[model samples]
Target: MTNIEKKVIDVTGLSSDQIAMLEEIVAALKAVSQTNNYQGKVSLDRLEETPQPSLTLEQRRAFLQLTLEERRRLLAQQAENMVEHYQENTEWQEFLAGGIIEY
Candidate 1:
């Protein structure tokens, strides 16, 4: 039997088909991991959960005092952070599985 090699991947740049391929590989791993003592399952629930953040009083005050340009830069950074965590829509999974989600 061959060993499975795993690597840390940046999923943000992966297309939907690449994401689907990863999912199928994971499912196969989980199936093989089952034995007399254990059954493995993975949850993708966080895909739908939105992040919740609360600022401390000092942080809020600092944010409020930022100049317009500084605020724009900060907001742009925050938006990019959010987009980096975005989930692929479910409807595209089938198309993705075929490895050609787009023409």
Candidate 2:
């Protein structure tokens, strides 16, 4: 295989569809980085210094009104939904089969 073809298949065990999607996402990120003149360094310290929208007191109060159990249940449901969504992708099933380690 040519180097281009070899690079495309570097991600072992993924379906062709998954590889195509991955390539598209990678291309998009590369385009964004080039257009924005980004050096590709990911630093959360810079992000922390960026101004973020603040929640109003009422909005904060409403968000905090959920009981701990209610919050946990909501979080669990969201997690389940995300897992199900990923599970529908054959590539994700292969990833899960290999197991994932979270940092």
Model 2 residue 86 lDDT score: 52
Summarize candidate 1's per-residue lDDT along 1-103 as a digit string, tens digits.
Answer: 2223454556787678656655554454345433311111123665343333444454545555544665576567545544433332343445567754547
Tell me the number of clashing residue pairs for each predicted model: 0, 0
- On TM-score, the leading prediction is 1
Question: What are the per-residue Cα lDDT tens digits for candidate 2 across 2-102?
Answer: 01112222567767755555555445434533443322223466743223244455434443554466456545754664565455435545656864676
- lDDT (CA) for every model shown? 0.46, 0.45
Cα RMSD, each candidate: 19.0, 19.8
> After best superposition, candidate 1 residue 57: deviation in angstroms?
1.9
- Model 2: residues >4 Å from true position, as ranges? 1-61, 91-103
- Return the TM-score for candidate 1, rounded to 2 decimals: 0.35
What is the lDDT, from 0 to 100, of the residue 66 in candidate 2?
A: 40
